[model samples]
Target: MTTTTPPTHLPPPYAPTDSDSDPDSTFRHIITSMLNSHHHKFGFLIYRVNYDNDALWQNYLNIIDQQTREYVVLEKKEHLLPHIAWTPMEDREKFEGATKDEIREFFRDWIHERSEDRDGPGAGVDNTELIRWSPRYKACMYVNGEMMQGAKMQTVDFLPGGPQLHVQGKGVVVDGQYDEHDRDVLRRSAVGAREDFEEVEGRRGWDVGWMYFTLRGVHMVYETLCMSEEEWTSP
Candidate 1:
């Protein structure tokens, strides 16, 4: 049986013109709409790794830690974290015949181990905090564009089937799927966002801006997922 692929394409970086709505305003609208309609509690956290070039992974772990801490404080109420998962390209190729359930389990176990207290001395920093780790897989590119004066949007696409996080001014929107082609499109899309934004900035003579507001999409997904999972699995 043929499988359907998920839609994954990074939207080109856009700068508002006289005729365009303020990017920031539009971003806020999107976020507010998402939060008001979606039945999930989402939040974001940022972190830097002490060493290594894997900033994404480090950031992911940092966010996870933050979420965990929040979960503890809230007594696992309101905020729930998502199940962490990853699918390395090498591993996927090595086990081409692996079933979806098997792959999910593999990632689930990997995430659980990484989250365990034994991963390292600092693994469990605080029972009240959660750490953010990088996404399980790598994307071709992660494009972050300035949506407004202090706000930016990040769109990422990874290889194989995965999820896309849209970071807007008010909140985040996450959509997940399991399709290789969609993954490819998302990877390329992220690259496109980066290129498009860079080109606009160069042409307009604007300095590179700090990403804010919209960069929390991933964190939102993680928190919502975590909360939902906890509720579902709770006795």
Candidate 2:
């Protein structure tokens, strides 16, 4: 819940744009811009921290009375969670016939319990806080062309004197091939690799460098990445 300020020398924060008008768009923009490499001298590795949706959904049912439907979800704007839907569970029997508003209320309450308003023992961990607080997505930067062998590894701190932004403060490239944000580059990868992109905790190196970003720093990086290729590397 705490945040560190970004270094002042970096470019100004990025202004909100219609380009990120929705959650899906916002998520995509964050993932895309951070993964883009302005120069071959810079390389990026990212790992997405996906929600344990299935397990969390099952936890929600513990509060429901009696047997409920196999699936009970409410449609949300988040594209990553499309399989979920909303429906009345056995708890509806209380009202004899749950009204539309009642069903919505029940669903809303379930959502709230997962994040806030439910504490103490057996309240369950807040999945929302887990998604928000835990580095949902980790990004690593390989500087000085370290991505290619035979090149000496070097570190680059985009925001210096702010927060430590290197993986263990040593220039090390994360092992394994990463899913590139560039569509063309991604398409060139083997179909199987593309189909089953690995999910990782970033304990290795993906969670290093720009892993944790402040609000201001995020905006700065987003704006910097969105800049023209020429502008990106300019002094």
lDDT of 1 by residue, 1-235 (tens): 1111111212222222342234433223222322332211122212111122244433443443443344333332222223222111222232234433333443344334432233322223342222222221101111111112223334357734443433333221212112334544554665543233344323311212111223344444333334331111101
lDDT of 2 by residue, 121-174 (tens): 112343322212211111222221111122121234566544322222122222
Clashes of 1: 33
| Clash count, predicted structure 2 | 3
Global local distance difference test of model 2: 0.25
User: CA lDDT, every prediction?
Assistant: 0.28, 0.25
RMSD of each: 19.3, 21.6
Give TM-scores for every candidate, taking all chains together and pairing residue i with residue i: 0.22, 0.17
Name the TM-score of candidate 2. Answer: 0.17
Per-residue lDDT for 7 in model 1? Answer: 17
Best by TM-score, which number?
1
Off by over 4 Å in 1: 1-90, 93-99, 111-118, 121-216, 232-235
* TM-score of model number 1: 0.22
Stretches of candidate 2 above 4 Å error?
1-9, 23-139, 142-146, 149-235
